[model samples]
Target: MAFFTRLFRPARASERRFSELVGPHIETMYRMAWHWTRNTHDAEDLVQDVLIRIVNRLDELEAADKPQPWLIRVLYYRYVDLYRRRQRSPVLPAEDCAETGFAAEAESSVMDKPDRLALAAQLERALTSLSDDHRDVVLMHDLEGFTTAEIAGVFGISEGTVKSRLHRAREKLKGKLHGSF
Candidate 1:
């Protein structure tokens, strides 16, 4: 009995520690996931997937002092994997997408402030127009307030590449928004 108890004690303690460390960042992770997925259901699914991955790799995460970037990196990679998988699959018919109601919600959300909402919609369109790499860099650095170094870390690239991507992304956004305004 003593041996069995001793063997399980550390595992339980580690699980508790993991939860404590990760609990505070759940909302942030969900927001980031939502930005990437652009829908509540997909965002929740993505966050759930990320949490599962983190829990599975809890041993490796024990040494991580700051887990936000690590968590974001996991989320980003998961999104990319899903994106690739989606590309390989056949597109669903329009009827299949009717249940999501994403378009109706989007339109209603913007109805309150016509000018600002229009501009925001334009910006979202521009963002979606960007290549995935450029869009990720821009979103991480600008909207999420991550530094170039941190963005590089998240993407596993150098700071110079991050800066270059960010610069080009901003230029592309500027061109897209210029015509709108």
Candidate 2:
């Protein structure tokens, strides 16, 4: 009876603990998801799905943990899943996506104007052209400004590898943006 009761109502203290500990990082989770998806709509959907998983997986987290790395792990795995599904399909008709209620208009767009939008589109193209390792490292570390150590933790790669990827990615972005590639 005590076990069931505890299960039903996780100690009030635990909720407080989780919020105090991980709440601040929740925005990072959303940004991580958004970066991976490349569109606001898909990012929001991805983050929403991850939110459910994070809630379910909270118990697996050690007490007094930072929760950022674990949250990145969730986002990374989900992005992998999403990347696979995208490769298999390659394209989804607008009607199908809308009919299935799988998309959100609020989060999905390429710029709305011509000149500025063109540059943004070019930037996205450059980003997608990168290898996954480089793209992930750059997204988390350079664009989002995660520390070398934090990025290493997020990608399960060495700090050396993260630094290497960031340097290479910067070179690549420069060439691509300058039309020198």
- For each candidate in turn, the TM-score is 0.75, 0.64
Assess candidate 2 and give its lDDT. Answer: 0.67
Clashing pairs in 1: none
Model 1 has a clash total of: 0
| CA RMSD of all predictions | 7.6, 8.0
Considering summed lDDT, which 10 consecutive residues are worst modelled in model 1? 1-10
Q: Tens digit of lDDT per residue, candidate 1, span 21-110?
A: 676667667767777777767877787777777787876676765787878888889988997887788984233343233233466676
Which candidate leads in TM-score?
1
Model 2, span 47-111: residue lDDT tens: 66776666645577654255677778778888889778877995862432342111232224633
TM-score of predicted model 1?
0.75
